[model samples]
Target: MRIPSYEDMLAAHERIKPHIRRTPVRTSDYLNDLAGCDLYFKCENFQEPGAFKVRGAANAVFGLDDEQARKGVATHSSGNHASCLSFAAMRRGIPCNVVMPRTAPQAKKDTVARYGGRITECDPSTSSREAAFAKVQAETGGDFVHPYNDPRVIAGQGTCSREFMEQTDGLDMVVAPIGGGGMISGTCLTLSTLAPETKVIAAEPEQADDAYRSFKAGHIIADDAPKTIADGLLVPLKELTWHFVSNHVSEIYTASEQEIIDAMKLSWKHLRIVIEPSCAVPLAVILKNPDAFAGKRVGVVITGGNVDLDKLPWMQT
Candidate 1:
């Protein structure tokens, strides 16, 4: 498989510009005081699909050729990617097939369907999801857009950082929540050229710390069914994503379940945004380790806000 390049990211920016939003960068005095740093929140949750995954999804769907478009695209995701790809395909008047875990939030499932995606439910395991997806892809003969592994997806994801650098000046570091590392990889891709001085850090849930483990071990380590409230980040990193994580990422940090929930609530209370648990990982890490980011101009990617209003993690009975 070919690796995505900086030029590809440039092209992806142009190709997906019309489809995805240049999500705003936000900040909070309270958050800055708490973290002892200037925190610039890239509000990807403001996306129409309520996630940054749409950046890559739109790039892949719209970049597809007529032949590929007719067959459409297929992917297996925990949540955000499925809905975003569905939204993009819908915009292009094409089909999207999603193989999602049955345990994924109902809000995500409903959003995918709302975007006209056909979902095939799978067991909540990397093994099971991939196993089921193989059948779906074979039957549909749709081009596969691996949720975070594809070069197109990574290149597409790189555009976010391009906009991030353009929107803000002199960012010392950028911290984004990592699942399969698409966002992190894209951040690496863009920052390597756009702002080489800026460090790219990854935040992950301790319960699902495969990426952290992989980073520390200098190799990829995957968990088939890791449990975490940050469902969007349950998947393990693939070769494409791992390449960037291993080479470009400066560090990987983890936060506990309660930390994630507390951070999620803090964003809702202060940032006044409805963000999912996955997006809270960055803030959780930043808050937990103030010394690392203190005095730095830190940029945090608020990855998504597609949480189920009825099932807030902190409100669990």
Candidate 2:
């Protein structure tokens, strides 16, 4: 669990330039007026493979040599990371083995399959997924690309901040959702080094608040069952991420399920983007607490767009 440095992130941008998309930062006058702030959305949902996970996955896979790439790669992901890794593996002309929960969305699974990667379903528990992934690594001799805990992965994630900063001006705060903490950890590191005055805030779901709890407790907290519609945020925080977050982040806030659903619906109806629950978490925070960010320039990292189209979480039946 090593945190990536700003220099490492800059290098990662160079390494992954040809592979990952430098997605646009979009602004909405409607959202800005409602929140009382000038808001810029880093639309990673429009990113290649439809998520920011591609930045890390592509960097990790491409960083490997010909022989290492030939050995293939393995990881456990319930959603976006799997698709990104599959796409990365395809780029290298090697096989990608992804271990996912049996209950993962059909859309995500189909996307991974379309990218020419092999999928193995396992129980959703951390231990089970790890055991399954280890078996695949042993059997196929593939490199293990962790979803959010690796330094190279963190470095790749930091590039999002680089792109966001370049596309917008005068951001006072950048709010990003936290899961295993890869995105925020990398984002905070970049802001701390490049824009020290801009505070980084983490948006967590009330149902799965490991990062928030850990932030309040002043140490790494674990052993809590995650129960949230933001499935991507269910993973426990890693040591590297916890350290970076505690030192660099200004605060962490939690949003309820209904709040997330409202935000998701609003984004689709008003913003006209199909944002998943995890992607809606940051917007939920702003919607829930308007006083804090009112009249300030803020950046929201809209994480990904992968979702179950047949059964959307917020659409009333």
Candidate 3:
């Protein structure tokens, strides 16, 4: 697969602007005090589709010509990507076929279906998900929009950071939760060109820290169904995403499951905004390592808000 460049990101930004929201940037004084750093959150969760994935999905779906659009788009995602792609497809009046793990959050599955996407269930592992997606793709003949790996998707994701940079004067670091690396790759694609001095950092769950391990090993280290509260982040890095992660990402940090949950609660309590556990990983890691971010202006990507309302992780105990 080809790697997305800055130009592609610019084109993606323009293409997706009509379909996606220019999500707001929010700040929390409490969060800043707790982390000892200035925090500006790019509230992607406020998106109409409740996730940043919509930007990429809209970009990919809208970029397709009449021939490609006729058949529609297909992808495999843990949750947000599936729903967002479905929303994008719905906007363009096309079909969207999604292969998702049966174990994904019920809320996410419902969201996908609400947008008229056909769902194919699969086992939770990456291997099984891919196998199932392959069958679906072959049958549907839809344009494959790999959740994170495709160049179009990465370029689409890059728009988030471009918006972030414009909203904030500048930041010392831009931290986003890493799953398959689409959002982070997008961040890298934009910042590496747009704001070369701004560091792009990745936050991951310690339980599903394959990306971190891969970073240390200097290669892709995919996990097989690693469990974590950050369910949206269970997927591993692919070639296209690894390209940006290896080159442009400055650091990768991790937080334990409890830390993720605690941070989720903290954000809800202080920021007064709903956030998914996956999105909370950035704050979790920042709080866990305050000295690293002390006195710096940090831009945090609030990735999604599609949480299972009844099964809030913090409410379990």
Candidate 4:
């Protein structure tokens, strides 16, 4: 696969600008004191589709030609990407077919449907999701937009960090939750080019720490259906994402399930925003290792806010 260039990222920003919201960068004095650092939160949760995935989804959807757009796009996502892609397709007035894990949050499924995306549910495993997606693609002939692995998607995700840089000055580091590494890869791509002095850190749930293991192992290490409260982060790193992780990431950190839950609740309390568990991993890691970021100006990417109100993680037994 051809790696997307800095130029591609700039092009993607231009292509997706009109379609996506330039979400606000928010800061909380409470969070800053807790983490022992000045923290700037890029609020992608305020995105139209309620996630940063819309940046990539919109880029991929709008980048397509007339013929490709007619067939539409398809992908497999645990949650956010599916809804975001559906929202992008809806904006383009095209069809979007998504294969989501049967265990995906009801809120995400509802959003996907609300945006006119056709959903095909599969078992909560990478193999099962791929198998289900293959059938959907075969039937519809829609262009396949890999959630994190596609170059177009990564380039699109890069736009987030670009915007973050424009919003904040001299960020010592930027941290983002890593799943298949789409957001992190984008962060790496943007920082490596635009802000080379800034460190790029990836945060993951200890329960689903494939990227962490992969970073330590110096290669790709995938997990199969790893159970984590951060459901959006259960996916493993693909080759495209691994390239960015191995070469550009400053570090990989993991947070326990309880830590992730606490961080999620804390952000909601202080930031007055409902961020999903996946988005809390970065703050969880920061709270876990305060010394690493104590004096730094850190940018934390809040990846999404799509959660089922009836089954909040903290309220679960």
Per-residue lDDT over 1-317 for candidate 4, one digit per residue giving the tens place of the 0 to 100 score:
99999999999999999989999999999899988999999999999989999999999999999998999999999989999999999999999999999999999999999999999999999999999999999999999999999999999999999999999976999999999999999998888989999999999999999899999999899988999999999899998999999999999999999999999999999999999999999999999999999989999999999999999998994
Cα lDDT, all candidates: 0.94, 0.88, 0.94, 0.95
The TM-score of candidate 1 is 0.99
TM-score of each: 0.99, 0.97, 0.99, 0.99
RMSD of each candidate relative to the true structure: 0.7, 1.3, 0.7, 0.6
Off by over 4 Å in 3: none
lDDT of 2 by residue, 1-317 (tens): 45578999999999989988878887788888877888889999997788999999988998998888888898999789999999988987898999998878888999999998899998877778888888988999888888998898888999999888888865899999998998998898788888999989899999888889899999878643477788888788888888788899998999999989988888888778877889999989997889989888899999999999987886642
Give the clashing pairs for model 4: none
Error of 4 at 41 (Å): 0.3
Ordered from best to worst lDDT, the candidate numbers read: 4, 3, 1, 2
For model 3 the TM-score comes to 0.99
